[model samples]
Target: MSSEAEGRFHIVDVSSLTSVHRRMPRRVTLRTDDGVRIEAVYEPSRASVTDTAVVLAHGFTGSVDRPAVRRAARAFAERGASVVTFSFRGHGGSGGLSTVGDREVLDLSAAVRWARELGHARVATVGFSMGGSVVLRHAALEAGTVDAVAAVSAPARWYYRGTAPMRRLHWVVTRPGGRLVGRYGLRTRIDRRAWDPVPLSPVEAVPLIAPVPLLIVHGDRDAYFPLDHPRSLAAAGGDAAELWLEPGMGHAENAADAELLARLGDWLVGG
Candidate 1:
């Protein structure tokens, strides 16, 4: 594999790394109906009444502090839109175990409601990988709740494309040598069947989000999720959705591309 491809697959410590100026994010807590409280970082827009707020959701096994998520939040904030980044349940500072994307959708729903209460008239959700699935599912479940949506490297057909690799990775990380951290919790504590992404697949949810401007961004070289997933979603949405295939870009490439940022910003501004 090429060096860039290698970097794309390797996971890094996003929370420890600092952005350009080493700025600290403003933090807050969002409480769910089930009484689960999640940690989130909020960055308000610089411009007056942008009419749109972007809620950033990280991927499975990812936290709000993940570098890509933080970068996206910062970029949206700089562009005059309120940005809220939060950890899904069992990910970072949040409580409870991860239910893959099923229960996480509730957490996202709560966050979106919180944003609405904060004077945001139109809400846009941006999610990466597993996070993408959550937002897409939310849009479908709660139609008319979100104004716009964007997802990067999100899986559409989960059973076939999603589980094989993640299951192996889970075993590797939760096994003896990597068991020092206790990140995924006991195997008995997690429902292996529930972790399947098929139940939360976005392929079935795309048609449900019709007429609600959707933007599906995926890299042509994405190793995790193939390009066809996003393309399928865009096709499902017909003219209602926009799909962008970043040339030579792999999964979660938005963190490093200005052009991707521009495309997202333009979509947000209804440009």
Candidate 2:
């Protein structure tokens, strides 16, 4: 064989590649209270019905097609659980505008209802970045409905005491120049107002989720939310919650790390 062909054959790890795609197609459109249709992809359980379901929420300016979102869906589905991933209003193929975490909470509630209607007795949520805050807040407000929650790199206090980097990012995105250009062509005026980085303040809501298992994961080197936020959240939850402070990982590592995936899977499995 040619040297290039030999190298390619050696580098390919066939064992890691699936011979066929095992994922099934799932399309759901949830109608919000305001008459907006929210787009979501549901991945049903590959194993028997465990009365458990997993919901994946994307970060700000993100869509359900994000790499992390897809990996999470596949990860949970492979574990014999159902997975649902959706785009926030004004994000991806969803309708309406982003209202930061304030209005997005309603969208999340709608998702939870959808999961319940699908016959999932126990529902857990996993969110990344801003989506993390949404899940945290939802779990707090709707404690009776959500069985558990895992938030990766979520900001605990956004309105105040947020990390400096995130504060700066908020400024940049909401600034006149940033708003005027409108990166996504989302109606600059509406987009600019929606991009405001107001904190969702999950700290206040932490106690509400007590007794309900919570998993907080944050990268020590996270530039967006910083480690303090997760620490605060875990501390607020006391012994009821688990905090995984990855030494070298940065934000959104849970979507890629096998160890992190295992931890999350175990939590969802009632370990």
- After superposition on all CA atoms, what RMSD does each candidate show versus the true structure? 9.3, 11.4
Per-candidate Cα lDDT values, in order, are: 0.69, 0.70
lDDT for model 2, on a 0 to 1 scale?
Answer: 0.70
Q: Estimate each model's TM-score.
A: 0.79, 0.81
Error of 1 at 19 (Å): 28
Tens digits of per-residue lDDT for model 2, 1-271: 0001010111221133231222444565676656556777777776665678788888777777767677777777777778878878767767666665666787788777777766667888888887888988988877788888888888888654356766655654667765444444533122445533444478777778877888888888887777779999999989888898888777773434766676676677573
List runs of model 1 lying over 4 Å from the truth: 1-26, 161-167, 170-200, 253-256
Candidate 1, 28-132: lDDT as tens digits? 666665655677666777554476778888876677776777777767776767787888776676666566677778889877876776666778998888788
Candidate 2 residue 50 C-alpha distance from true site, Å: 2.1
- Backbone Cα, N, C clashes tallied per candidate: 0, 2
Model 1 root-mean-square deviation: 9.3
